[model samples]
Target: MILRMAWRNIWRNKLRSITIMMAVALGLTAGVFASAMINGMMQSRFHEFIENQISHLQLHHPDFVGQQEVYQHTGVPRDQLDRVLENPMVRAATVRTKVHSMIASATYTGGVELMGVLPENEKQTTGFHNNVVEGNYLEKHGTNEILLGSALAEKMRVQVGSRVVLTFQDVDHNMVSAAFLVTGLYETGYTRYDESFALVHMDYLNNQINIGNSFHEMALLLTDIDHIPAMTKELEVMFPGLHVRAWNEVSPEMSVLVEAGDVFAYIFLVIILLGLAFGLLNTMLMAVYERTREIGMMMAIGMNKQRIFALILFETLALSLVGGVFGIVGSWAIVSWVSRVGIDLSAFDDVMKEIGFSPVIYPVLETAFFITLILFVMLTALIASIYPSLRAMRLNPAESAKR
Candidate 1:
């Protein structure tokens, strides 16, 4: 009976009721959609770094991790790699000889982190070959072949088949210079990364540095990301001498940024809801003021104050819930359609790439987020109903009945 009365009371002023409902719906839709877009951008950037660049876990010599010394190889035998590969959770693994070196073309020179990797293993682990936008990936038997990032190529004014000079200290700390053919130019849409890294054939680099088949880094991609913590511990136990680190440990800033994005999304939604709460408060207060005479008549007819407060509370909740349902359904439909098609910010392509974000964004929201949103709406309605319900209960029956 109370619910039916509450539902019917809101429609007594149809214009005001519909106006508040539409306001709530529009505010929630905008807030949820904005949150979804931010989520999508953060997820895209994080996965791009993890899957295509960093992998899930890495193994390195203690000195190599600390100082990046070329001679600080993992010192583990090749059989150790075979053992790691035998693990069921390790989906793919590759070893690389990493060095900080200067790469120079005829026109320009720049610093690069040169990674010498087995082409097939590297491809399986990082799928870097898929990013080759121009020319071919390193050939299986290719010697002295190098793949330069597209940004690096542009900065160096080099192209496919261009001869470039690589200069670095060999394992002995002796400066060594060699010529490498640029077999490919790849772009991962992370401009800073593209400008800072290059790849070469492992055997060729090993012979050049006089480090026979030794590698400084071992990167691994796991079958499931949820296994990262367990796998990191397992690898540590297996290779007690080598330093094993998860992707988050390697890049703490990215992890922090992803977490901050989630917090910011909720904060933003709360700010919007607060605004809606004020709107709800104003509307309910006015409704209470206008219906004073009606409420007084009920009170005179023996309706108790507690029931009167509950009626007002129920009316506020009903108004909010009806609006919330419409808003959630509308936001879901918009998010679903937008996620499928994606929102292109091609106009900001260069800036987006420079900052390690994709130009295209696909909005997404978890089911749990919608559930929480409903709870938030209910809470807001309850808080907004408080003052108005108190005012309704405080009215004098004789005076209100006369008015």
Candidate 2:
């Protein structure tokens, strides 16, 4: 009976009721879309940056990461690589030899991190072929050719077919120098990597260091990202002589950024709910004022005070339910559109790449976000009605009727 009365009473003030519903709906919609978009952009950037640039997993000698001075100290043997790659979860693997070196071309010179990679295997693991911008990826077993990042090429004032000399310390602590012909140039859209790293055929690097069948690091790709922790544990158990780290473990800064985005989303959600709470509070207070005479008449006719309170509470709950349902449905429609079309960041490509992020992102909406949003809006509406409902119950029939 109270629900029927509350429902009929809401129709008596259709304009005000609709205005409050619109405010609640808009608030909820903004909250849902904002959270989804930010989270989606962060996740997309993280996956591309980590998977394409940094492999899912890395194997190093116990002290290799700390003292990456030479390619030989933390070198993993070629024979051991085959055993590690036997795991079903391992999709691909590559061996790398890295050293800090000074590169010179004609009149220009700059310092770079020289990476020695196997031409054939590196592509299978790192998407190195797709990142090539100007020329082809390195050729197998080639000694005189090298690939330069676009920024590095510009720094050294060199292009394809230019000769450059690279100087670095060998495994024996002796200075090693080699001349390489620039066969290709690549732009990864990541400034830190493109400007700082150079790739060379592993054969030349091994010969310079006088080391055979050894590498500074072994990078691996997994078929599924969820299997990273389990596979890392397995690798550790299988090869207790080596150190293993997942991409998230290797890149703590990126992980923190992803987590921080989530925290911010939650904070914004609370702020939106608070605003909706105030809106609901105002509406419930107005409804109490407008219906005072009607409520007093019911009390004068011997209606119980508790029954009057229940009627007010029921009306508030009905309004909340209607508004909450519409808000959730409307948000779903907006999120679906944005997720499909995506928000473009092409104009900010240079800025994003400078900070080690991908330029384009697609939004992802999760079920938990939707469910939590609905519950929060409904709870806020209920809480907002408490004071208004109590005030109506405390009114004296004589005083209210006189007014």
Number of the top TM-score candidate: 1
Q: What is the lDDT, from 0 to 100, of the residue 195 in candidate 1?
A: 94
lDDT of each: 0.91, 0.82
176: Cα error in model 1, Å: 0.5
TM-score (C-alpha, index-matched) for candidate 2: 0.92
| Model 2 whole-model lDDT (C-alpha atoms) | 0.82
TM-score, per-candidate, Cα-based: 0.97, 0.92
Q: Kindly give the number of clashing pairs for every candidate.
A: 0, 0
Candidate 2: list runs displaced more than 4 Å.
302-306
- What's the distance in Å from true for residue 153, model 2? 2.3
- Model 2 lDDT tens row, 189-233: 788789899999887887887767688888899899888989989
Score residue 20 of candidate 1 by CA lDDT.
Answer: 93
**RMSD of candidates 1 onward, in order:** 1.2, 2.2
- Alpha-carbon runs more than 4 Å astray in model 1: none
